[model samples]
Target: MGLLDELESEAQRRKSNDEDASVLKAARETAYRTVLEPAMADLLAYLKELAAKLTELQPKIAIRHSLAGYGDVVAYVEHEFDVREVRQPSSKEITVAFHAAVSSSECPSVQIEGGARVRAVSASFQRHRLGAPLAASKDASGEVVAATFKAKGRIPLTAVFSADAASGQLRLSFSNFDDFATAVKTVAPDQVNEELYDKIGRYLMREPTDLMREVLPENYRSQLRARVHHEEVKRRWESQIVSRQQEDIALLKREYGIGARFNRIGDAMGKLRGLVSRK
Candidate 1:
C-alpha cells in the first residue's frame, strides 16, 4: 500500500524474473564456449593467415592499379571486418559470420575522367563584313569516382565466412570484385589486435547481448545505454526503499517497546497508535 511496500513488491518481481534471466544467460554462455568460441578461433586464424598471404602479394598490387592525373595518386583504404552472429528462429541454429564484404566506405576515390561537353558556332563574312562566334555547353560527364571502379581478378577479396553451430559447418560467401587487394594486404598485425578477439569471446561467453549492443549504431547504442541506466537506477532505488523501510521498523520497535512479533509496517503503526492512546 505504501511506497516502500510497492517498491519491495516490484523488487520481488524483478528478483523472480532475474532467476529466469540467469538460467538463459548460463545457457548462452555454455553455448558460446561449446559452439561459438571454436568457430571464432578458427575464423580468426584463417583471417590472419589470409592477411599474411595478401601482404606477401603486396608488390603485385601496383600491377592491378592504373596511374592517373599529373602526379601519382596513391589511395589506401582500410578494410573494416565486422563479425556478427545470427540465430535462426525456425530451428534456433546459431551462425557466426566474419564479414569482409567490400563497402563503398572501404574504397578509394580516384577521379580518372576529366572533360566537358561544349557547343559552339562561328561565322565569318567573305569580306570580313561580319564575324560572330557563339558558344554553349552541355553536361555529359557522370560523376565517376574511384569507388565505382570494380576490382579485377578471381581473388576473393570481399568474402564472408560463416560457421554454423548446430552442424559445425563452415561456409564461405563472396561479394564485390577486387580492383586491388591492397586493403587486405595492408592490415597491420596490431590493427587486428588479439584483445579485440578476446573481448568478443568474453562477450559471447558471458554477455551475448553486450556483443549485439557493441555493433549497434551510435544512436541506438545511446538509447540502449539510457534504458540500461534507467533499469539500474530503478533497482538501486528499490533496494534503498527496502533498506529505509527496514530501518524505520527497527527504530519504531526501539521507541515504542514493540515486540519482534510484528512484521508488517501497518501492524507496527497500529500497535504504535494503540500504545500512544493508552499513554
Candidate 2:
C-alpha cells in the first residue's frame, strides 16, 4: 500500500478501539493542558499580582475595620487575637502556648510582651483611604495623618455563550457516599467519571468566572485616576523640595567662594596700579 493508504488503515484500526483510545487521550490532554500548565500559570499570576499590590502596603494598619460596609479600600493586614499565658523558658527556649479561656463574654485585648511572638497577618491589604475625602484619625498627641475611609472593588465579565446551549442538569446519579464527600471537598476524586469534571468546569465558568462577572462603579476610572494623580503629586512635591534645597546650598557655596576672593583680588589690582603709576 501507498503511504496515505497505510495511514487510512491505521486510522480504521484506532477507530475499532475508539472508546479506550478516547479515555487515554482525554486523561493525557487534561493532565498536560488543563491541570499542570494552566495551574502553574494561574498560581504564578496570583503570586505576582499579590506581590506587587503588597509591596507599598503596610503590615499592620489602623482602620475602622468592619465586614458590614466597604470603606476606602487599600492594603490591609488582619490580626489574630489569641489568649496565652506567659511561661518560663526551658533549655531549648521554645515558647509554648495553650488555649486560655475566660468566663467573661468579651474577648479582652492583651498587652503585647516584648520579644514574644504574637499571631499577626502581614503584608495584606487593609483598606485604601483618601487623605482629603477620608475622615482624619486622631489621638491624644494630635491629629493623625492616615487614610481612613476604605472601599473594595470587583472584576466585571460578560457571557460569550448562549443560555439555552449552556444550560445543563447537574444531578447526583452516583450512590457512593465517599465519592460524594470527596466531590464536595475537591469537586472530584479518584474513580469519578469525566462528566463530573465537565459539569464542574461549566458551572464554575458560567457562575463565578469570566462568563458572569461583576458590576463596577460608574466613576471607577475617575476615582482611580484621581488617586494616582494625588500620589504622583505628593512624590513630585517632595522630590522638588529636596532638589531645591540642594540647589540653594550649592548657590550659597558659590557666592561665599566669590566673596572670599574679592578682597585679595582688589588689593592685588591696587598694588599693580601703583607700580604702573611709578613707572
Candidate 3:
C-alpha cells in the first residue's frame, strides 16, 4: 500500500516481462541458427548441384517429347526430368521430393488396327467421359466430367537426414532415384480394362458406329462409371499432395530467409545468454 512497495512491485513486474521476451527471442534465434541455418545451407548446395546436373543433361534430358495419339495426331509433353542424382551435398541427408503428373484425354477417331476399323480413345482417359452408355441418372443429366489419370508420390527424390522427420518418405523409396516411371504407374488412376473398352466402342467414338448399339453391355457401363469415380478420388488426393508439397517447401524457405544473419548478433546473443543465466 506504501509508495515504495508499489514501486518495488512495478519494477519486479517489468523485470519478469523483459525476461520472458528475452527468453522467447533467444529461443527463436537458437532454433534459427542451429536447426534452420544448417538445413538451409545444405539445401542450397544440393539444389545448386542438381541444377547444374540437370543443365548438363538438358540436351538429352530436355528433348521435345511427342506422343502419337489417334489418327497420326501427335501431342507434345513437357521435358520430363530423370532423377539423375539425389542431391547428396553432405552427410546430412535431404529429401529432394518432386512431383510428376501426366494427364491424357481421348480424341474421337477411327483407326485401322489388325485390318479392322476400330473406334478408340486413350486407355487412360477419364472414366466419366463415357458415362452410363444409355442409362438415365443424375450423372447423365449433367455434362460428363472426365478426370485425369494422375499418379504422384513424395518419394524417389525425397530424402531425410534424421531418423525421424515429418514427411511422406515412408510412402516412397528414398533410394529409388531412377524409378520415376514405376512410381507414376503405381500412383496413377486405374485405367478401364480392355474388356470394358471393347464393350464401350460405341460410347468412345466421337460419332458412334452404326454397327454398335447405344445400350452398353450388362455391367460394362457400371464398371466404367466405377473406374471413373475411383480415378476421381485419386486426382483429388494427388492435387492436394502437390499443393502441400509446394506449401511446405515455400514455408521453410521463407522462414530461413528471415534474419538470415548479422555478424555482431552472435556475440550479442552470447552476452545476453550469459546475463540471463547469471540472473
Candidate 4:
C-alpha cells in the first residue's frame, strides 16, 4: 500500500504540471495571431510606399532624366550654344546656359567687345506661365542682327534674346527661356508633377542619423546601445517561444498518450507558426 500511494502521488504531480504547460502554450499562440503579425505587415507596407515616392522628383536635362530612387535621389540639367564671326560691328557674341534646377540663367561672358555696348544680361524662369515677348535688331550694313533683353523681377523669368549668325545659320541663345517654355507647354503636367513628387520623397527619406541624435534625450548613449539591447530582447522572446513549444510537446506526450515523435513534430509546427505571427 505504501508503494502504490507514492506512485499515485507522482502521477497527480505530472498531471498538474501538464495542465500548467498547456495553459501557457494556448496563451502564446493567441498572442502571436492577434498582435504580432499585423504589426509586421503594416511596417513593410509603409516602407514600400516611401520608396515609390522617392523615385519621382528628379530633374531632366537634354536626353537624360534625373530623379531620386528608393535609397537616394538625383537631379541635373545641361545647356549648349555656339559663337561664330559675322560681318557686323558686333565682332563677339555671347551664349547663356540655363537649367531648370537652378531656376535662373545669365550670360557669364563679361566686357564683350567689338559690338554695341551690351548694357546688361540676365534671365528668368517660370514652370508654367504665358510666353513673354522678345525683340530683335539689325546692324547698319544689314549684314548682322542681334537680339537682347533686360533682367527684371523674380525667378521664372525668360532669357534675353541674343545670338550669333554665321554660315547661313542663325544660332539663337536665351537664358531660361527655351527650357522653361518647353517644360510648361510641351511636357505633360503629370510628368512634371511626378518629378516634383520624387524630390519631396527623397527629402523625406534622407538618413535620420543626425535627426535621431538631435531628438534623443540626454539619457540616450551616443553608441546606439539601445538597438543592441532591443535585439537581445527580441532574441530572448524568440527563445521563450521555442522553450514553450518544447514544454507543450512534453506535456502532450506524458498526459495525452501522444507519441514522442508526433509531439516533436507538433512542437516544430508550433514554433514556425509562432515566428510567423510574432511582431
Best by TM-score: 1
lDDT of 1 by residue, 61-163 (tens): 2112222221222223233334444434311222232222223233343323323111111111111111221222224564322212222112223444444
Candidates' lDDT values, in order? 0.41, 0.35, 0.38, 0.37
The global Cα lDDT (0 to 1) of model 2 is 0.35
lDDT agreement of model 4 with the native:
0.37
Preferred candidate (lDDT higher): 1 or 3: 1
Q: Clashing residue pairs, candidate 1?
A: 110-146, 151-178, 151-179
Deviation (Å) of 155 in candidate 4: 43
Each prediction's total of clashing residue pairs, residues at least 3 apart in sequence or on different chains, is 3, 17, 2, 12
**What does candidate 3's lDDT look like per residue over 2-43, in tens digits?**
999999999999999999988866764554445443544544
TM-score for all models, in order of appearance: 0.24, 0.22, 0.23, 0.21
Kindly list the per-residue Cα lDDT of model 2 for residues 160-229, writing each as its tens digit: 1100101111112111111111122221112124443344334322223221123457699789889999
Flag clash pairs in model 3: 95-159, 96-157
lDDT of 4 by residue, 1-279 (tens): 699999999999999999998886665444434432332233234434553433354333321121111011112333221222222432122222233333223311122222343211211212222122135454687622343332222223222211111111112223333223221111111222333334323322332222112245556764568788898999999999999999999988787665766889999999999999994
Q: Using lDDT, give the best candidate's number.
A: 1
